[model samples]
Target chain A: MTGQFPDDLPAGQPEQSATHPLPAYVPPPGDSPPPDPRTAYAPTALIDLSIPRRTHPASPVVLAARIVPAVYLGMLLPLGGLWEDIGLIPAFGAAIATILIALVAAGFGWWSWKKLTYYLDADGDLRVDSGIFQRQARRLQLSRLQSVDAVSPLIARLLGFVEVRIEVAGAGDSRAVLRYLTKSQAEDLRTTILAKAEQRTKSEDATSADVDGGEYDPAAPPNPANLANQMDGELLARVPMGRLLGSLLLRTTTVTLFILTVLFILFTIRTQGVASLAVAVVTGGVPLFAIISEFFTYSNFTLSRTRDGLRLRNGLLQTQTRTVPVGRIQAVEIVAPLLWRRFGWVRVQLTVAGVGGEGQETGRAVLLPVAPRDEALAIIEQVMPGVAVDDLPWVSAPRRARWREPFQWPFLAWAATDQVIATRTGRITRRISFAPHARNQSVRVMQGPWQRALRLATVAFDVAPGPVSLSALQVDLPTARGLADAQADRARLARLHQA
Target chain B: MTSHVHEVDAAFAPPQENWVRVSPKLITARRITLVLGSLLEVAVIVALWLIPGIPTWIAIAATAVFVAVFVWAWWLIGRRVRSYGYAERETDLLVVSGILIRRLVIVPYGRMQMVDLTAGPIDRWLGIATVQLHTAAATTDAAIPGLPPDDAAALRDRLAARGEERSAGM
Candidate 1:
């Protein structure tokens, strides 16, 4: 509250600090020999003892997972060029060849288990070396390595191993992926590489020479910004059941299934029962689909903090993993949908510097599926420090509501518009309730220009991700404009920094 | 070599023969080659139709469309490949490109994450290669196109060295 950075944050993870201290990083030795072939170019830490170790064959079960690829390739080959009319013997032979190729590939898949060995050089590069038939040694100098992505695949999940992929600079999908390693091994590998890079850097320059030779300036610790470790709670919001379920039903496949089920039941029934069953299907479908949709939308959603980047892993059938380094996030925007406006919730997205569109791996990266209204501003504060979002107090706006009550009917003719709660092609969709929940409290105001001139205010209250009807209080419009303007000004102050 | 300098690292010096620079001229030539290649493709399609059991009108329509598309494509591809330009700035590297949406990407010197120097068949044929610059952030990545082999390698080496230099805070 003193407007000064606290020496200590609210709290940081004890385990995170003990395991990931910045000062002691060293790289593991990989394939490259340590004879100083390219001069004393990189530091000695990277030139560890064991780089050219033997390739450990993959497990047979690893190949079993590859059945998906084999089956896909098997179907594609005959259609692609293999089974063409080069005579029945050749065609039949081609089919046989396809199976043989699949078998050989499956065997190779089992055999090509890989471990990428890495270490940090004194100059601050995380060098990785790995390959099977043809060994490829890739050096991602510390500065160029963007994100260190760690994931647990279905196999790794059960086997207690984690796969790590390094996102490095340059083009054409250059990444060093280590398929199977213990969780501890990955953490060590990450530490060693970064540490070596930092050390090598220290070894450079006349001033650095004195520092590396060993002098500890407590005030200017090696990584003075190491205190940034205290910054946590990057999580913006949690996606609740209502919005998640609503979105699922909006998908084409789920709706199509419902339509199909309706047709199937109607035909199966007799004439008298047909109409009743048709009504029953429609009545049951909305709630059933909503529940099913919620189940589909957020089956296993978890966002976690890594040392150098943010890791997002999600999916129902095919799990996808994406890691974004702090440096790459461009613009962050929080959008509150009409449903969420009812709950005062928002969805956060970060614009990333890249050609690809949004995905776990793409731009305007989704930060949180959902979060509370007030928490949105707080999350933005930690991730992008420079953007200043003001916490201001202001008036509210008036909304056009359709009503037939004695006082409402005549007032509806000259209603203050532009305050839409839930609109379908410009038509309002009424809701059951609009009162704010006991746990969730927020100040709301709405205004139109004319209403603002008359000092009118319309207050809307809701506790979930949808507009709550019959709970808005109409006052002067000027109060609504003042409040809306203040909020807009606060949003304008936020920025999503460029890459 | 200029003498009198003491304790110089011989590795810093350039070789006796100079490396040819890849110019915009070859980019134009590549575009021309594309036109020729398209013509040859259309000719093959026409040739197939001209053979004894095929219809002439189908071949005519196909060749007509191919030629039309090729004619329209020449200007587009020429301008796009022509617009691709790369230069090393004091602070970082710049790659400016685009036919429709102009883009001038500036990768800061200190932020460069990796440089991958590559030469495929077409590059070897043209006596040129490419350098891809990647960053920790996926979005800020760029490729320096069409440098003569030695120049590309030298650029990579320089960038790698500079990358290390800056990262080391030197």
Candidate 2:
């Protein structure tokens, strides 16, 4: 790594040219020098900023392990055809070429891993520089950092390595990943980064408060009492393995598959045949895959709240630990599928700012995959203090709106408290979404031709790009307009109060 | 019809109808594009007609339908352009548009992330530009097109200043 830096560095500093163990590159003017590598590179260093560091040496091996299987799968059929069409010599040559390609890929991975370096700059912005041929540098502002996730895939976990993914605000391209770090190193890095990010936000708030004569500070830390539960973090909720599996079995897909299988079995018995049962078995694959994937993704799911933010840990095969700052959660949603409702079970999800938008990794956005309604509500209360879904003054959609959505119109309702705006929609799979007024980006009232004819409109409270879509559909036009205006007013007031 | 229009306006009307309407030149610019697109379609139909195995009646029917659709769109363009309106409130901006599916979006100044001013070739030729207001939410599609360049610039500056003053971190 030291040798590679000099080749890229501009020619200068002849005095330090003779086999200097560290790169001789100078820090930017007025900025502090990089920390000593010996101290900074220590595994136990808490806040190792301003020092370029490489991931574990096993990064290349892990990358190759991930890639070789894909290469083999892609080349297998073509190589097989070559073996049958041509004789043994050409087949052997193709096989050799494939091996050489895989070897070259492994070598490239090693080179890229060697070149990749990440560090925190003087401004506390996380910078990652990677790519062997075309160097790609990404700078993520710590102040805008949303979440830091440490994920370990099955192979990487077996190899005792973790990947750190940093999610920042704005576009999808703002995300940065540092792959294949030792598990301990990744955890320390996450803790240090989250702490530093919180520190930066607090300092910025302090300065802004000074400018405003210490007026309301929206970014002020949440309840100090809550802060008392820091460091170790209080485990808010943990789903037992049995409950998780039970929830998976109770899902609509599994229930529907069970029903179909039973019906197919009865039909097969009547016909004295087993051939059509194969159709049911084949159709079962869809729900089977869902169950297995969901089981692995959500098994042993646990949520805890620490000083830095909310922490989530889950996954059996590929474990992930994500830390989302309290301020980053734009909206929270509670979904109760038709089947789960009978068991009083609900799934809690969050729309986090700076995370991936629609169709993001469901595991990351999920707060609780399956929990009793009361348990989920308890966690929600902890996450968003003082806002109770049941206590809000709910108003259902007007009866006239039923023409637009006959069944769902009854479920379409909205409530606005001083702190948050909540919308409940859907009939079969009920969903209620809560978004703080301060977090709402905008509000919209829309009317289609049919809706206009019925004097009805849909009011949507727009939060950051995430899965939690908070909207009240098919309300009276006046009510929709009023909601939009009032929500905007409340959002503005909330922002001012918070500020 | 007038009462229906009034009812529709009442649903999303600004406090006192202080909406700043876009330049009427928008209709002309849009009409130009419409005519150009129709001409291209006509050319394609004519080419098909000249092809060895195609029938003349098919081309004629295609041209007739295309003309009818173009005429409908051309007629609707004026109302659509006229429908575009925006109101600058004390703390938020309200943009109302769409003739058939009317929409009114209220974007708080504090939530605004960017205000973009863009002008296409035809719009520039017409001396008009578009001002797009972006909030943290990507779903907030608030764009006021066919504004005079000076108005667009003025709006952009005002929105940006307000956004800075009322900066609400996401």
Tens digits of lDDT, candidate 2, B9-105: 7778976657889999999999999988778787898797888888888888998898799889999999999999999988899999989888899
What's chain A's TM-score in each predicted model?
0.47, 0.66
lDDT tens digits by residue: candidate 2, A1-499? 0110111112211222122222123335576456544223322335466799898887887877766556665666557776656656554655566677767877887899889998998888889999988999888877656566678877777778889888665544567888888877886687667667766656776665322112223444432211222322557789999989988998776888878877888888899899978977866777888899989988979987644466678889776666655566778999998989888999989987534322143213788999999989876776676678778799999998788898888888999998889999988889999888888889998889998788778898988877898888887766667788889999888877766
Best by TM-score: 2
Highest-scoring model, DockQ: 2
Per-residue lDDT over A1-499 for candidate 1, one digit per residue giving the tens place of the 0 to 100 score = 1011111223322333333324334334584445322222222222242344322234334444445445655655655554455444544555566566667765665556544455544445555665566776665644434445456666556666666666654454456666655665555554444444344434452343322112212333343113223212133334555555554453344556567666657665745466667655765576576656555545454454433345554554334445554444533445555445566665555544431212233344566656675675675555444233332121122343322122342222111112111111111211111111111112233333333333333443212222112223444333333333332222112110100
Q: What is the TM-score of chain B alone in each candidate?
A: 0.70, 0.89
lDDT of 1 at A385: 41
CA lDDT for candidate 1:
0.46
- Residue-by-residue lDDT tens digits, candidate 1, B10-44: 11111223222245645755675786688778778
DockQ each candidate and list the results.
0.01, 0.40
Task: Locate the minimum summed-lDDT window of 10 residues in model 2 chain A.
Answer: A1-10
For residue A434, model 2's alpha carbon misses the true position, in angstroms, by: 1.1
Q: Give each candidate's fraction of reference contacts reproduced.
A: 0.00, 0.74
